[model samples]
Target: MLDKVKELNEKFKTASPQEVLEYFLKTYKGKIALSSSFGAEDQVLTDMILKQDKSAKIFTLDTGRLPYETYSVMDNTNLKYNIKVDVYFPDAKEVETLYKEQGINGFYESIENRKRCCFVRKIAPLQRALQGLNIWITGLRASQSITREAMHLVEYDENNKVIKLNPLLLWSEEDVWDYIKTHKVPYNKLHDHGYPSIGCAPCTRAIKEGKDIRSGRWWWENPEHKECGLHKK
Candidate 1:
């Protein structure tokens, strides 16, 4: 799988994002899926994938603590595309135990607590969402943060044992917005108010204009520790 992913990256080095989507959507078919977060980049991918294949799988993880705007855009996306995007949620028992152990917002106290919260709310649910899949599509861009700087167009996610496809890996922040506006894609309202990166309501915030796009997410932690284990290398 690793060798295949390397070959794929080489083959699509100069391909357009749509071209990448078209090939994966047809070749992999039911064995592939896009894990959307309903952010600008993901919204763009959703439009491209649906345009090529309406039956293409696109899913999102509902952390249960997401902001209202995230849900709002999610509904708008479903209406616009006329397809109900699949949603995955964390285990009820795990969430219950998390609260008991952390007391609602214990994530603020330490990195361990925060990671624990993310595991229960995001990672665990994501693992379930990726089950039995050969390819996992994402909206990750290299410029988003330090953690994502070394990502490739296609790579193997050993954590999930799937070929991770980053269709928008090389897209710029400007490129993402341009695609969104050109396509008139439904995006999260939070982006209009300075939230460059949107996640669960409590974990995300609006960043200053010049800050890193990912600065808004997990703002309390160091840049190196910002990731929630979803795209862990």
Candidate 2:
């Protein structure tokens, strides 16, 4: 797996995202799946996956705190693709306990509190959704963050014990939008409000121009440490 990752990276160093996706589809077959948050980049990738293989499984973490538009897209995607998007929800007991003790806004107090919220709402559900999958697809790009800057089109995810293929690793924000427009893909309407990255509703908002892609996400924290821990190694 490591040798194949190294081989594909050097071979597709200059290849477009479409090329990388083609390679992934050819390689993994049904053992692979795409995890999306239904943002523009995600919708772009989803369109590509459907074009390549309509049987490609797509899933998302609900987080139980998403915007109404995200929920609408989930339903819209089902009707558009004529396929079911498996929704992963948090552990019921954990969520119940968290809400009972700390209330909903506890995440604003500290990083620990935030991680706990993420664990229940996103991470735990993500882990459940990944079980039995040999490959995991995502829409992450290098330009999104310094952490993702060193990423490749294909890499092994030791955490999930699977091959993590980021087919759009090298795409820019403009590239994603262009693809979406060209394909007429369905997307959330919040992008026009300076929200380059979208997530659960309460914890996300838009940022000013010239800011980073993830600056609006978990913005109250030190910039270097604002990740939701889902994509963290």
Best by lDDT: 1
Each prediction's TM-score against the native?
0.99, 0.94
- List, residue by residue over 64-108, the lDDT tens digit for candidate 1: 999999999999999999999999999999999999998998999
Predict model 1's lDDT versus the native: 0.93
Model 1 misses residue 175 by how many Å? 0.7
lDDT of each: 0.93, 0.86
| Location of the lowest summed lDDT over 10 successive residues in candidate 2 | 16-25
Candidate 1, superposed: residue stretches over 4 Å from native: none
- Candidate 2, 70-143: lDDT as tens digits: 88878888889888888899989999999886788999988998988998999899998988888899998889
Model 1 alpha-carbon miss at residue 221, Å: 0.8
Which pairs of residues clash in candidate 2, taking residues 3 or more apart in a chain or in different chains? none
Instruction: Give the winner by TM-score.
Output: 1
